[model samples]
Target: MARTRPRPRPVATGCLMGRLRGNPWAILCVLSLAYFMAQLDISVLTVAVPDITRDLHTSFDRVAWALGSYVLALAVTLITAGRLGDLYGRRRVFRAGVVLFTLSSLVAGLTTTVDQLIAARALQGLGAALLIPQTMALLVEAFPVARRGTALGVRGTVGAAAAVVGPLVSGLLVTVLDWRWVFFVNVPVGTALLLATVLVPDDDRAPGPARLDVVGTLLVSVSLFCFAFAVSQGERYGWRGWFWGLVALSAVAFAVFLRQQRRRQSGDPLVPFELFRDRDYALMNVVSVCVSLAFMGLVLVLSVFFQSVLAFSALKAGLAIVPAALCSMVFGTVAGRLSDRLPAKYLLLAGTGLTVAGMLWTAAGMHEGADWPRFVAPLSVIGVGNAFLFTPLAAVGLRGLRPELAGAASGVLVTTLQIGSMIGTALSGALLGGGAGSGPTAASSRSAMVLFAVVAALAAPACAASSRTPRAGGTGDRAPDEDAGRAAAGRSPCREPRPSGPGRGQGGVPR
Candidate 1:
């Protein structure tokens, strides 16, 4: 006697709408608040470097470590944290991260010694690494395909806004109160977010029976940490034996990680090799890394130039970035909406061109006594370009991932972003220090800006290459796997898979 299959439940639009309508933005708000706290810690602390150095009797290098440690930790653990979320549950990991981060923030604020603060900041980074990927996974799971662009647009806008607002908020607090307030501020916000997260429903998606690649995780962590450390300390150590030794170790670790990944191709790899089979996804990853590097480097140099070279107050320097931030928010939202209607390639190309143009403008216009308007327009233009670039790249990167690997892909993407930022900060800082003696006045800053402009110019070719690929799910046909599932559920059999490679069945569906 054959058993009858379970009946497929009808998808009720009213029920779906009802479930979503009850504070749908709650999750986004929680994630955004956490993100804002992290950004604030990084940016705000930079402005308080002098005060920290004076109070703690620390050198510039030690103070720099306070920021670098957090960045390095975040980059190293990002992919690992994402895998953890996939193995357990994103909601659980996210809540854990929030609790850890809030506690770490409190510890950081109370720390008396520099070493204690550095350790606290590193802990905060660990929390951020766990929190970030889950946010992306949650967003994808919470929103329907039709509304995803809007949701992501809001996410991008909030991140950009935080980048702008963090410095200003930090400046005000540092000037009026003390540097400890920067970390202390996260406590209340984090507490509120933690409470709100309990209301957001969990995604009930089934998890795959994949083992965590512990060896791969260790190798990747060592490689990234060594690389970040070498870059961060390169100027002090120079190209001496110790520096080269670290670089060599990093190279060896990278080689080992690649070999391990290749060995586990048939099994569940830490980072699935199959994910890179799609040329568009591969190129987008490259673009994402490069774009982040350029943006972070430019911002670092510009902030320093405005403060140290131009003698602007911390508050004034923070406010200087506001025009660009506001413009980026507006354009990002508009571009996200347009991406739903237009090809992502066009938006990327246009954004890349604008970015290049803005960088060129900065390189040309920056001078000791440059008018505010000249800098403002270029900054705003760059922000607009970034707005266009970020959302579409995000939309494109995860466009055709399988549901099972969505969390992993999101982790990879966010990891690249943080890694790129770390590299950018290190490289840009090196350029500033290296070029310090080349001239008097703000010449070093100008030279560093030129380096950033060169990087921005390179993005155009990458964007052009990306624009040539066809959009995901453009074949207008469902895959064989989806068809089989539909038939099993008693729905009419869907169309056959697109005539592509073996992995094509899982490649077209947006995770």
Candidate 2:
């Protein structure tokens, strides 16, 4: 008798299914590798900008487009990317992003003109848009509720802190290998991550009929492009009629998109309005944007100051940020662990408070004939702020979200970060008298530093409001694991315990 043949796994071109599955922690490590690649790309590019502008014979205006195009691509595609993961399998979407990112990096490395580089970077952003949200969603899905906070903390510690360390790494890479290596570097890393990702267990797609919000996606994509383009160019172009027109169009598109989202039934909202009902989630998101505004701008300003004002070499300028990065790593690891037990609000408050102080210290020390040593102490202070704010803040914002909505939520959160970073970079440029490179005056640095401090200081009140917001489903106290379990299944904790409680604070803020 002929024996039955063993069934072969289905193979789709350019698609993968995970085999030889590992535990959640191991999978997180795999995801972190990819996340690290994304973070490093940005950091290295930050240091590479001057070199790129020189080699390509481009003006500051064109180089700005290179950065702006990447951000616009990220903002436009983020929601769609997240929704695709919900509709198809997230693992498939993630791997595709890796391939896209790697190819773009290779092309970016080979580009001879500024426009070609801009196009390649935009593609790189698209790849990032696809994979970044999935990594966050996957982390939320994999960890148990009791360990969820800790898990997120670890992920944040790596991903967030890497951006801080990226300058040093990028500096070295650019110094030794040239600015092109910044993009070339991702090729090998992305390949490694793509292979590692294939070992994780297959993630389940959202059950039941789910459709991508095509109309909503289009509206938001257009809206983001208009707003981001206007914002990036507003200061440079003097906010002309065309500029304000784009801003107006962005507003109109946003309103129309919200209207469209309101018509959708429970299972298919692109951005679930209900999530905003929890004040903690909403306020924490605000805090997310504000905190990032402060953090990202300082990097650009200080990096410029060190390299230009102080006349440090790329490697030396990059090395200067090491104190802050080291501080963030040490503090971030501890904060990640603390987020498990402490009220995230307290940590947020401390972080913001420290940030304000740190910013003040750094700003006051700025002068044309500055002593570089003075910066180290203040920067180290800001590093401590990173420890307190970065991971704990993320844990709080995502605290009560349902697992199924994780992709959507993560997309929004990361978008806020990118937006904030853009705002900060733009604002820094404006403060520096609308230019960069070897001309950052002490007065301008002071002004920008003060502005960032005030912006970051807003987090204190936001965190206070977040502390008062109720958890999702308007529920009272529950076990951590129980909380995760109920949320994982899309069953609100409010239902079992009844919605009639003091859980809803003023503004209907839910934690």
lDDT against the true structure, per candidate, is: 0.73, 0.75
lDDT of candidate 2 over 353-415, digit per residue (tens): 887898899989877777667778888888888778877766677667665566777788888
lDDT of 1 by residue, 166-188 (tens): 77888888999998888898899
What ranges in model 2 sit over 4 Å off?
1-20, 206-208, 435-439, 468-511
Q: Report the CA-based lDDT of candidate 1 relative to the real structure.
A: 0.73
- TM-scores, in order shown? 0.86, 0.85
Listing every candidate in turn, what is its Cα RMSD in Å to the true structure after a full C-alpha superposition?
6.7, 8.7
Candidate 2, residue 227: Cα displacement in angstroms equals 1.0
Worst 10 residues of 2 by lDDT: 493-502
